[model samples]
Target chain A: AQRVTQVQPTGSSQWGEEVTLDCSYETSEYFYRIFWYRQLFSGEMVFLIYQPSFDTQNQRSGRYSVVFQKSFKSISLVISASQPEDSGTYFCALSELGTNTGKLTFGDGTVLTVKP
Target chain B: NAGVIQTPRHKVTGKGQEATLWCEPISGHSAVFWYRQTIVQGLEFLTYFRNQAPIDDSGMPKERFSAQMPNQSHSTLKIQSTQPQDSAVYLCASSLDITGSQNTLYFGAGTRLSVL
Candidate 1:
């Protein structure tokens, strides 16, 4: 069994400031991938970024980046220069490699509110 | 592309009634996945299919839930005897393939299901 945890239920940040959402996972599999997604108020889910278990490099995309701590089995999504439009629920997900199953176990998510 | 398309953006069902959700994956995407989202559980993987074949359904409820993909383009998730607890946002996603570390999923604007 695998589980993902996001302790922060809500987060708030000022415009242009950086906001970090924490995530941790427990999995016995040696290979897996972690993903970040944002759900808009319209109910659409937008992909943000991902980090593979084997790659030690942290992934960054535009205003979004990931701090992957493999030793502690934890990861965090950092949103730089946050804007009001960045307000939404951000989810962290995990996918096991070689499972041939496209199933993703997701965290409870952190609702982010960015003040303009 | 239009990305993954889920039908009936909103639905209201009476107790014991049946609810069926539809999904149309992006063209050329070989993998499709279904997930249920709620405030308490976050995103729960319901099932997945690859190349029109049922690949994994371990996350689906054994009795009242079922899913099928008759072709490569579309899939369906059916919930029998819908209950109030079943109310949630059901999401559909698709990816080109489910291999290695590059399998990124594109999601649809989820269907919001409400049981009365």
Candidate 2:
């Protein structure tokens, strides 16, 4: 069974400050992927970033990047220059590779509040 | 591309009533997924379909929950004898294909089901 965990239920950040949200996962599969998504207030989920377990180098997309600790089975999302508009519940999801199920296991999410 | 579209932004049903949620995936996408989100459970995978075929439904409650993708244009999730415990936001996502490990899923706004 694959599972994702986000220890922090809530987090806060000031405008223009950097924010980091942590996540961990348990998976028996050798190949897997960790995904991050932001749920907007309108109830839409926006894909943020993803990291593959086989890649030693972390993945980065614009201001959003991930610190992937593959050895520890953990990953952290770093958002630079956070703005109030970034406030929402962030979800970390896991998908086992080589499995055609295409199922995603998600974390409890962290409600982030970016104060302006 | 208009992305994925879901109907009935909100739904309310009393105990024992039936509810149906709709989802229209993006054109050309080959994989569709159903997920349930609640304050307590976060996001849980319900079912998935690929190439218009039922792929996996291990997470669906066998008794009252069922999903179907009759055509490529849309899908439906039906809940019979809806209970208060079934209240949640139903999310639908679509991926271009499921064969790749980095397939990113585009999500819809979701249907908020409130069971009273």
Candidate 3:
């Protein structure tokens, strides 16, 4: 079974500080896809980023960026200049390509609290 | 243009009751995914559809959970004999493209299920 494990359950950081959320996965497939999502109290889940293993390119959109490392079987999301609005539950998900299943295995989320 | 739309943002049902969750994918999207999220289990893939056909449902519970996508624009997930344990947030996501590395899933606000 493929599983994405995000060890940190909760973390707090001050505004304008850098915060990192770690994710690691174990799967038999040689390649995998990773995704980051933020879920708020309103029951809305927002897509933050998506990364495929073949392309090591770090996806950056404004203050949010994700780094995918194949060798370490890990992925990390870095928030630069974090703000209060960034506080939410962050999740990591993965799926192996070619399966058409479109089923994504997600990790237990990390709740981030950005303080003012 | 509405990304993914899920109906009945919240539902309350009794054990053994039946509940159905609906999802309308983006206008031109061909892939739709359903996931269940809870505090204990986090996010789990329930099933997926590609090109209006059932692709994979390996993550679904066999007895009470079933999903269908009769057309490209909409999909439905039905749960029979709903139990308190089945209560969770059901999320739907859609992507314009189903293949390759660029497929990004845009999600809905999710439907929260409450069972008594």
Instruction: Tell me how each candidate scores on DockQ against the true complex.
Output: 0.81, 0.80, 0.70
CAPRI band of model 3? Answer: medium
lDDT of each: 0.92, 0.92, 0.87
Where does model 3 exceed 4 Å of error? Answer: none
lDDT of 3 at B41: 78
Of 2 and 3, the candidate ahead on DockQ is 2
Q: How many residue pairs clash (N, CA or C atoms closer than 3 angstroms) in each of the candidate models, in the order given?
A: 0, 0, 0
Tens-digit lDDT track of model 1 for B11-109: 999999999999999999999999998977778888888899888888899999999998888999999999999999999999988997547898999
DockQ: the better of candidates 1 and 2: 1
**Tens-place lDDT digits, model 2, residues B6-104:** 989999999999999999999999899999989887788899999889989988998999999999999999999999999999999999887565378
- Candidate 2 ranges beyond 4 A from true positions: none
DockQ of candidate model 1 = 0.81
Residue pairs with backbone overlap in model 3: none
* Real A-B contacts recovered, model 1: 0.82
TM-score of each: 0.96, 0.97, 0.94
Comparing only chain B with the true structure, the TM-scores of all models are 0.97, 0.97, 0.96
What is the C-alpha lDDT profile of model 3 across A32-57, one tens digit per residue? Answer: 68889888878788888877888868
Better of 2 and 3 by TM-score: 2
Best by DockQ: 1
Query: Relative to the unseen true structure, what is the C-alpha lDDT of residue B20 in candidate 3, on a scale of 0 to 100?
Result: 97
